[model samples]
Target: MGTYLITGIGRGIGQELTRILLSRGDRVIGTVRDPGQVPAEWEAFVKNGRLELLKLDVRDEASIADAASRVNEPVDVLINNAGIIGPDRQSTLNMDFEGFLDTLRVNTLGPLRVVQAFLPQLRRSPQAKIVTISSRMGSLSYAKSDRIAYRASKAAVNKVMQGLATDLAVDGIAAIAVHPGWVQTDMGGSGADISVQQSAAGLVKLVDRLTLKETGGFFDWQGDAIPF
Candidate 1:
């Protein structure tokens, strides 16, 4: 079974991904900002050695480095899922600069930092994949400006993922950004279209079929390509 390292698995999509992976007998190394608050359902997996939880905060470099240092096994897949919705004051005409900066730090740069810290373990894998949980709201082609800070951060991250795909090609490490559809979560709200279960299921399927050919492309939860 392949070993997958997922960030922010305390709840929402990341937590669901962990559930699916662990149920299928795959090893999962999940990261969360608070380890003590992890789900009680996961106690069995943690005791079985099939699941490992690392305390990490995407905004903290020291935490990411410390988490990476603890993982000695090769990670077949790395899912950068930790992100923020950004401050409420995000807008084109008016913005919270500090909050915007924090958004960029977590949503855009956090994944890259985690990848750099975990490169050694990724390289040890026979075939490695890096998946960043991006959003369609970030698409430049969309031309929508609401919540500009969040959009801009996602847009910038999409570019970063493309560059990573290019640079990591020689190493046979596939990196791609995925747009998880609007789902009913704390961020997506109750009015959202899909459920976490559906999104997570599709994401796992898409990630399983990923190859170098699809490394630079952006895709939806259903495996359909999206314009970045």
Candidate 2:
């Protein structure tokens, strides 16, 4: 079984992804902003030694470095799943400048920080893969101005991961972005298109098939390629 390191596993898709990985007998190192607030179900996995929960705030570099130092094994897959939706005020007409900047910091720079901090562990793996959770709303090919802050952040991260894929090519590491479809989560809301289970399962399958040829590509949870 491979070792997977996933960020923001306190709830939503992150939590469900962690559950699926553990159920399949893979070791998972999941991050949460606050370990005390994690769901009770996660505790059983921790007790059984299948999961290791670490406290991390994706926007904080020190936290990322500290968490990376704690990992003893090579990481086969690194999922940059932690992200935030900008405030309701972030619109084209009346944008919240501070909130937009914060959104970029978390959604864009956060994943880069985590990947750099864990590069050593990832490089040690025989088949390393880096997956960043992006959004279809970020696609410039089909642009919409509703949530401009979030859209801009995801778009920027897609480019960042593409650059990472190129820079790490010599090391044989696959890096790509994935759009998790609108799942029913705190951010996706109650009327979202798909359930968390569907998205998580699809994402797992996509990650499983990732290869060097597919690096730098943006894809949906179902493994379909998405235009940048």
Candidate 3:
């Protein structure tokens, strides 16, 4: 089984993805801002060395680098799943500028930081892939104006991932952005269309099918192509 590195495994899609991968015999290296936040049920995996948790805050480059340094083994896949919904007062006309900047810091720049710090381990693998969990709201085709900060951050990250796909092609690494669907999580709320289980499962299947040909593309949780 492949070694999968995932960010923000404290809950939601990240946690589910870790669980699925571990159950299938793949080793999981998960990152969390607080180690205490991890579920106790994963103790078995942790004890068996199938799951390893790293302390990292994506917004902090030093922390990301430290975390990356701890993993010497090749990482076959890296999933950038940590993100924020942004501030409550986000809008085009009225915005929380500080919050908007922070949103961009975490959502847009965070993935790049993690990827750069972990490039060595990724390069060690014969086939390496990077998947960023972006949102459909980031799609330029959609003109919705709500939550502008969050939307802008996702859009920016998508562009960054596309560029990464291009630059890393010579290294034989594939990178792409994916919309995990409106999952029913703390962030997506109860009224969301899909459950975290469904979204995580679909995402794993999609990742399994990914190849160099699909690099730099945007796709949904259901594996459908999406306009960026």
Candidate 4:
């Protein structure tokens, strides 16, 4: 089975992703802002050896480096799932610039830093992939309204994934952006249409089916490509 690293594994989509990966017999190294933050279920996963929890905060470079060093095996996949929504959704004219910056720091730059820090280990893997947990809100072509911060950061990440795909191709590593859909998570809210289980299952299927040819494209949970 493959070895994977996932950020923001304490709760919500990240936690669900970890559970699915472990159930599939893949080894997962999951990151949390604090180890104490992991729920009882996650702690069980950690104790069982299917999952390893590293204390990490995507906003902190040192934490990212420390977490990367904990993995002794080469990572087959890296999931940049850690992200945040700003204060509240609003029109561009009413959005706060500082909130937007915070969103970019976690959702955009955090993934970039993780890739940079873990490139060596990823290169050691025969078939490595980088999956950024982006959003449909990121698609400029499809975005008819404004989320301001969330949309901007995700869009930036989509572009960043493309650039990484180009540079990592020579080493046989693929990078792609994925939209997990609006699931019932803290970020997604209770009114969201999809459940976390369904979203995670679809995402895992997409991940297992990813090919080098698909790198740099934005995809949905159903494995269809989304235009930039």
Top lDDT hit = 3
How well does candidate 3 match the true structure, expressed as C-alpha RMSD? Answer: 0.5
State the lDDT of candidate 2 residue by residue for 1-228, as single tens digits: 899999999889998999899999999999999998677877788998899999999989999999999998899999999999997898899999999999999999999999999999999999899999999999999757999999999999999999999999999999999999999999999999999999999999999989999999999999999899
Q: List candidate 4 segments past 4 Å from native.
A: none
> What is the per-residue lDDT of model 4 for residues 29-126, given as tens digits with 9 covering 90 to 100?
88888788777766566777878888888889998898888777798999999999875745677877778888899999999999999998899899
Summed backbone clashes in each candidate are: 0, 0, 0, 0
Model 2 segments beyond 4 Å from truth?
A: none
Residue range with the least summed lDDT across 10 consecutive positions in model 3: 37-46
Q: What is the C-alpha RMSD of each candidate to the true structure, in Å?
A: 0.6, 0.9, 0.5, 1.4
Q: Per-residue alpha-carbon lDDT of model 3 for 1-228, expressed as tens digits?
A: 999999999999999999899989999999999999998999999999999999999999999999998999999999999999999999999999999999998999999999999999999999999999999999999999999999999999999999999999999999999999999999999999999999999999999999999999999999999999
**What's model 3's lDDT at 225?**
94
Query: Tens-digit lDDT track for model 1 on 115-216?
Result: 999999999998999999999999988988999999999999999999999999999999999999999999999999999999999999999999999998
Whole-model lDDT, candidate 2?
A: 0.95
Instruction: State the C-alpha lDDT per candidate.
Output: 0.96, 0.95, 0.97, 0.88
lDDT of 1 at 1: 89
Off by over 4 Å in 3: none
Error of 2 at 208 (Å): 0.7
How high a TM-score does candidate 2 get? 0.98
Find the 10 residues in a row with the least total lDDT in model 1.
32-41
